[model samples]
Target: MLTRIVRMAFQPEKVADFLAIFRDSEDKIRNMPGCRHLELWQDADQPTVYCTHSRWDSAADLDNYRRSALFGQVWPATKALFAAPPLAFSVYPAGVESSLSSLPASQ
Candidate 1:
């Protein structure tokens, strides 16, 4: 499985707007093909910061979603509210031994 995480820092006044967009689109995104799980998270120490945790069947499934019309609509609106560029990455669970070699080399 492919797990994806995206951390975003939004403009203070735009937090509500971002939530609304997520609320409107969450179900559609979760129902997309190969979507195994989806969640939204807010930082405890940073009110303006939020993250999305999602699981997909494969990297290609995630990529397909990235290119979909739903993403086209949601991403632009979401990024417009960002106070900083978002941080996004994907990984496999640590328990998955095969994924170990795919991790980036330590600095």
Candidate 2:
């Protein structure tokens, strides 16, 4: 599984618009091929800041979505609402067994 994270800082005045766009398009995005999960999160102290967390089967899956017409439409609308450039990255599970083994057992 490939996890993708995107941080967006929207213009304060455009937050509602951004949310509306997200509401209208989230279902389509979540239903895309190879999309395993999707979630939106808001920063605790910043009302204008939001992030999208998603899981894809692979980077190529993500790339396919990015090149789709859905992205072409959504991204331009989303970009117009941003106060700053978005930050995005992808990561894979980092050996869960090794991390679990390092944990101490307690009663």
Candidate 3:
């Protein structure tokens, strides 16, 4: 599995509005090929900061989404709300150490 995390810092006063934009965004990415899941997170210490954690089957899957209209619409809305350049990381999952006899719960 491939994990992609993006960190975004927004203007403090507009944080809620910015988050709303994401909440109301188009469904293009959600229906894209290879997208396993998508999640949104907010920093506990910094309310104006948010992050997106997504799991894709591969890098190519993410690339496909980026080139689609879903990204085209979402990017501009997201960028306009940013206070700083966003940071993104992509990683491959390492082995998990589990003690459960059956399948463990998802992280």
Candidate 4:
């Protein structure tokens, strides 16, 4: 499984517009093939900053969605509202095993 995260900082005045776009497209995005989950989050300290977290079966599935007509429509509109260039990346679980005993003791 792959997890994709995109953080967007929008103009203060454009936040509403971005929300409306997300509202209109969220379902379509969530329903796309290989999409397992979708969520939207706002930064606690930065009201105009938002992030999208989504899970996909694999990177190819994500790339397919990125090339779809839905993305074509949604991204440009979303991009136009950004206060800064968006940050996006994909990752998977490290599958590392660990225990509290491995940690340094607190003073």
Candidate 5:
């Protein structure tokens, strides 16, 4: 399994718009092939900062989704609202660890 997180900072006033985009697309994204999970999180101390957490069966699957029309449409819209380029990275688990508590195993 692969875990991915994207950290984004948006114009404070664009929070609602950003959230609405996520709300409208979360289910579709979660249902995509090889997608195991999807979630949106906002920084408690900095509400304009947000992060997206997701799990994919493989990096290929994630790449495929990124090239798909869904992403083509969604990403540009989302990117336009960002205050800066998003920070994203991937990780692989080494057995069970407390740091991974927030992630569930792929079903």
Candidate 6:
């Protein structure tokens, strides 16, 4: 599995518009092939900062979504609302099991 994170900083006034776009397209994004999970996170200290965390089956899967028409349309609009360039990164497992099953139980 691959995890992707994108940190977006939007104009304060444009945050609502950005969120509206997300609301309208989230389902389509989540339903994309190889998409396992998708979430939107907001920074408590910086209201204009938002992040999208998603898990994909592989890098190719992520690339497919990026190249899709849905992304082509949504990205341009989203980019226009940004206060700064977005930061994006991807990560894969470190060859260790990090699931809840590997953790000790609570008292």
**Backbone atom clashes (below 3 Å) for every candidate:** 0, 0, 0, 0, 0, 0
TM-score of each: 0.89, 0.88, 0.81, 0.89, 0.86, 0.88
Off by over 4 Å in 6: 96-107
What tens digits encode model 1's per-residue C-alpha lDDT throughout 20-60? 99999999999999999999999999989999999999999
CA lDDT, every prediction? 0.97, 0.95, 0.83, 0.96, 0.91, 0.96
Model 5 CA deviation exceeding 4 Å by range: 95-107
Give per-residue CA lDDT, model 5, range 12-91, as digits (tens).
88888989889998998998899999999889998899999999999999999999889987898899899988999999
Pull out the clashing pairs in model 1: none
The list of candidate 2 runs beyond 4 A from truth reads 96-107
- TM-score preference between candidates 2 and 3, better one: 2
Give Cα distance to truth, residue 55, candidate 3, Å: 0.3
Give me candidate 1's TM-score against the actual structure: 0.89
* Residue 29 Cα positional deviation in candidate 1, in Å, after optimal superposition: 0.2
Candidate 3 Cα errors over 4 Å, as ranges: 96-107
Residues 35-55 of candidate 2: C-alpha lDDT, one tens digit per residue: 999999999999899999999
Worst 10 residues of 1 by lDDT: 93-102
Better of 3 and 6 by TM-score: 6
lDDT per residue for candidate 6 within 34-80, as digits (tens), equals: 99999999999999999999999999999999999999989999999
TM-score (C-alpha) between model 5 and the true structure: 0.86
Clashing pairs in model 3, backbone N/Cα/C closer than 3 A: none
Model 4, residue 37: C-alpha shift (Å): 0.3
